[model samples]
Target: MGMIRFALAMAVLLSHLPLTNVKFIGGGLAVQAFFVVSGFYMALVLNGKYTDRGLFYTNRLLRIYPAYFVMMAIAAVFLFGFKASGTATLGMFEQAYTNPVTAIILGFEHILLVGQDILFWMKIEPDGDLVFDLANAPPAEDKPWAWQALLVPQSWSLSIELMFYAVAPFLARLNWRWLVALAAASIALRLSGYWLSIDLGLWQARFFPTALFLFIFGMLAHKALPLAMRLPAWTGWAATAAALTLIIFLPLAGLPDGAVRWITYVAIAAAAPFAFHVTRNLTADRWIGELSYPLYLTHLPFIGVVLTYEPPMPVLCAIAGSIALAILLFVLVDRPVDRWRQARAAGKAGPASTMAAATP
Candidate 1:
C-alpha cells in the first residue's frame, strides 16, 4: 500500500507536469503504474477471508481518513495563515488560504472517499466552452482550478480502487479458469472504458481502466506467485530479478496507446520477480508503506500550501516542509488510527481467532 501510495503521489506530481508533450514518458503512465501496483498490493493484503464487511471497511476507513483530514486542516491553516511573500500584495494566497472553503470541500472528497467520482468540477481545459463562455480559444488556453493539479487529481483513481475493492473478494474466491475468464473480460472492458473515456470526453474514464487492469493483474499474480514465494530466498530473488530484467526488455511499445494493452500485462508479468523480491522485504519495513494512505490523501494539499502563490521560497524549502508534514502525518494521524483499528479488531475477534491485521 505504501508503495502504491508513494507511486500515487508520484503519479499526481508527474501527471500535472508539462511532460504530457514529451513522447517517451507521461505522468498518466505513472498513475497507471500505480494502479497496477495498487492492484498487486491489495491482492496481497486482502488475500485472507473475513466474516465482517463492516469491520473490514471500518478498518480501511479509519486507516485512511484520520491522516487525510489532519492534512486538510494543516493545508487550510497554511493556505490561510502564511505570508504570500515579503512582497506587499494581498491576493488569493492569503484570502483563499484563510477561508479555505474550497480546500475544505476538496478535503471532504478524500474523507468521503469520493474525490475521484466528482464529475461536476470537470477539468477546465477540457470543458471550457461548456463550463464557461470562453470562446475561440483552444482548451490549452484555459487554466483549471489549482486543486486539479495536485495529488487530488488522482483521487479518481481511488474511486476506481474502491470499485475494485468491492469486487476483489469475489475475484479472490474464484478458481483458475474463472480467474482467467474474469481477467479476459475485464481486460476487454478496461480497454473499452479507456477508449470511451478518450472519445466520450471523460478523463476519468481513461483513469478507471488503468486501475481496473492493474487490479485484475494483481489477482492473477496472487494466484500464481505463491510458487515463487515457496522457493528459497536466493531463488526467489533471482527469479524476481530475472522477471524484472525481462520487463525492461519487453516489447511493450505503444503500451497505453496500442490496443495491445496486454503488453504491460506481460511487463508486469515479467516484473513479478521484482515485485516478489520487494514484497518479501516490505512487511517488516512498515513505515512508509503503512503511512502510504495518509501520505496519499494528505501530501497534495500540504504541497499546495507550500507552493501556493508560487512562493519566492526556495524549492528545497517546500520539499523539506512537505517531507516534514509527511512524517508528522504518519506520527500524529496514521499510526494512531491504525493502532485504534487493530485494537478494536482484536477485541471483537471470535474465540477461535488469532488476529486480524487492519491493513491500510
Candidate 2:
C-alpha cells in the first residue's frame, strides 16, 4: 500500500512538474486513489486504534497540520512574497492587494476557511478590468480564489478529507449492511448528477456525499483485507501492474474525462486491497509512502517558486527541492508526531490496565 501511495504521489508530482502538462497518470486519478486508500486506513484505525473520538481527531490533525503549516509558511514566503514585491504578477494575485503583511495573514486565514462555504458568499467587484466572483468563477480565477483564501489550491482535497474525518467514526460504527447501503446511496447521488445534467461541478465531485463512496470502497476493502492477504504474492504484483496500465490508458481511450476518471477510480479501488499485501513488510516502500503527503502538499508551491525564479534546471531543482523538503518534514515533524501518538496511546492503555487490575 505504501508503495502504491508513493507511486500515486509521484504521478501527481509528475503532472505538476513545470515543463509540461504531460498527463503521466492523471493527477485527478491519483487524488481519488488517495481518498480511497484513506477510507480503508481510517476504517482500520477507527476499528482497532483509539476508541476516543477526541484522540482520533487529534491524531488526524497532528498527522496533517505540522507539515501543512510548514508548507503554508513556505507558500507565503515564496508565492505571496514574490507577488507582493511587485516582481511577478500572476492572474492569481492582485497588485493592489499586494501588501506582504496582509498576504501573509490571509494565507494563514485561508487554511482556517477549510472549505468553500464562507468564500462562496464573497463577491469581489471588478475594478480596472479584473473580475473576481467567487460563486461563479473558474477554478483558475485567482483574484477570487487567491492563495490568501485557498493557501494551496490543491489543498481543497484536504478539506474533503476533513469532512470525511469528521464523520468517519460514526460511519465506521455502522453495521456492514448499513455501510453498504450508504455506499450505494453515495454512488447513486454522483451518477444522478451525471445523468440529469445538473452541472454539479467540482464541488459535487470534490467534497460531496457522492465522494463518500470512495471512502466506503476503502472500508469494504478493509473488510476484505484478511482474504486479500492470503492471495499469492504474484497476484498482488499482477493487479498493481494492470491497475497502472488501466490508469494510463483510460484517459487516452477517447472517453470523456469524467467517464475515464470514474473507470480509473473503480479499477484502482478494486486493486488497492491486493496491492496492500504486496507492500505489507517492505521498508523502502513504507518510507517513500510516508514522504508522499509532504510531496503532495509542497510540490506545487516548490515548483511554482522555481518557475517564478526561472533558475537553471528549474524543473529538476523543483523535484530535488520538493523531495528534500518532504524528507526533512518526515524526519523533523511527521515521525515525531507518530512517536507522540504512540506514547499517548500507550499512556492511555496503561491507565486502563491499572484500573482493570485494581477492580479485580
Candidate 3:
C-alpha cells in the first residue's frame, strides 16, 4: 500500500513536470486513489484507537499541521520576498494573503472547503485562461468570487483530506448500506450537476461530493479487508494491474470526455483499495508509503523554484531536490512526530492499546 502511494505521488509529480511525452498516467486519478487509502486508514484508526473526539482531533492536528506549517512558512517567505523586491505586483499577493501569517492562522477554512470540495473561487490566470483548463481558454472577464494562491496550488488536495479527517469518526460509524448509498449519491449529484450544465466556478472538477465516493470506497475496503485477505494474493496483483491499465491507457484511447471518461476514473479508484489490501507488511513498501506525503507536498513547490532558474535539466533538478527534501523531512519531522504520536497513544491506552490495535 505504501509503495502504491509513493507511485501515485510520483505519477502526480510526473504529470506536473514540464517534460514532453511523460504524462502517461493521470495525477488526478492518483489523488483520487489517495483519498480512498486515507478513507481506509482514518476509519481504521478512528474506530479503533481514537474513539475519543479530543484525542482524535489532537492526533490529526499533530499529524497534519507540523509539516504543513513548515511548508507554508517557506511559501510565505518566497511570496513576501518576491513582493518586497517589487518582482511581483501586490495585487496577486493581496488576493492570496491578508498578511504573512494569515493563511496559516486561518487554515481552518481551507480544511472545511475540502468537505465542500470548494477551494477558493476560480480566477483567471495571467495567461488569460482558467486554471486546470488544460485545453480551452475562457473569456477574459470571467473570474472567481475569491482566490487564494499564495501557497503551492497543489495544497488544495490536502485541504480536502483535512476536511475529511474532521468528520471521519462519524463517517466511519455509518453502516455499509449507508456508506454505499452516500457514495452513490455523491457520484449521482456530480453527474446530474454536469448533465444540467451547472457552471461551478473555477476548479469545478474538485467539488467534494463528486469525489467522496473514492474515500467511501476506502472505508468500505476496510470493512471488506478480512475477506480480501482470505482471497489469493494473485487477485490483488490482478486488481492492481487493471487499475494501472485504466489510468494509463484510457486517455490514450482518446475517448470523448464524458460518461465513459468519468466511469474510467471511477473504476480505477474502485480497484485501488483491493490492490492496497493484499500488499501487506513489507518493509520496502512501508518506507515508500512513509515518504509519499513528503514527496507529494514538496514536489510542486520545489518545481516552482526550479522553473525560475530555467535550468537545462529542470526535471532532473526538481526530482532530485524534491526527493532529498522529502527524505530530510521524513527523518527529522515526520518520523519523529509519528513516533511521539504512537508513544502518547500507547501510554494513554496502556495494555488495552494493543488489544484495540489488534482489531484493525
User: Candidates' TM-scores?
Assistant: 0.68, 0.81, 0.78
Sort by TM-score, top down from the best: 2, 3, 1
Error of 1 at 294 (Å): 3.6
| Model 3 clashing residue pairs (backbone) | 117-208
Candidate with more favorable, higher TM-score: 1 or 3: 3
Error of 2 at 9 (Å): 1.7
Q: Per-residue lDDT of 45-151 in model 2, one digit per residue for the tens?
A: 77666567887798788777777887767766866567421112454355324556545544554666365333332333323122334244543333343433444
Off by over 4 Å in 1: 1-26, 83-111, 118-153, 193-210, 235-266, 269-284, 305-315, 346-359
Better of 1 and 2 by TM-score: 2
What CA RMSD would candidate 3 show? 5.3
Supply candidate 2's per-residue lDDT for 326: 82
Task: Give the candidate order by descending lDDT.
Answer: 2, 3, 1
The sequence of per-residue lDDT tens digits that candidate 1 reaches over residues 263-287 is 5455554455344544544664346
Candidate 2, residue 33: the lDDT equals 75
Q: Measured by TM-score, how close is model 2 to the native structure?
A: 0.81
* Cα RMSD (angstroms) for every candidate in the order listed: 6.4, 5.9, 5.3
Model 1: per-residue Cα lDDT at residue 14 = 34
The number of the candidate with the highest TM-score is 2
- After superposition, which runs of candidate 2 have C-alpha atoms over 4 Å from their true positions? 83-113, 116-123, 127-149, 194-199, 247-249, 346-360
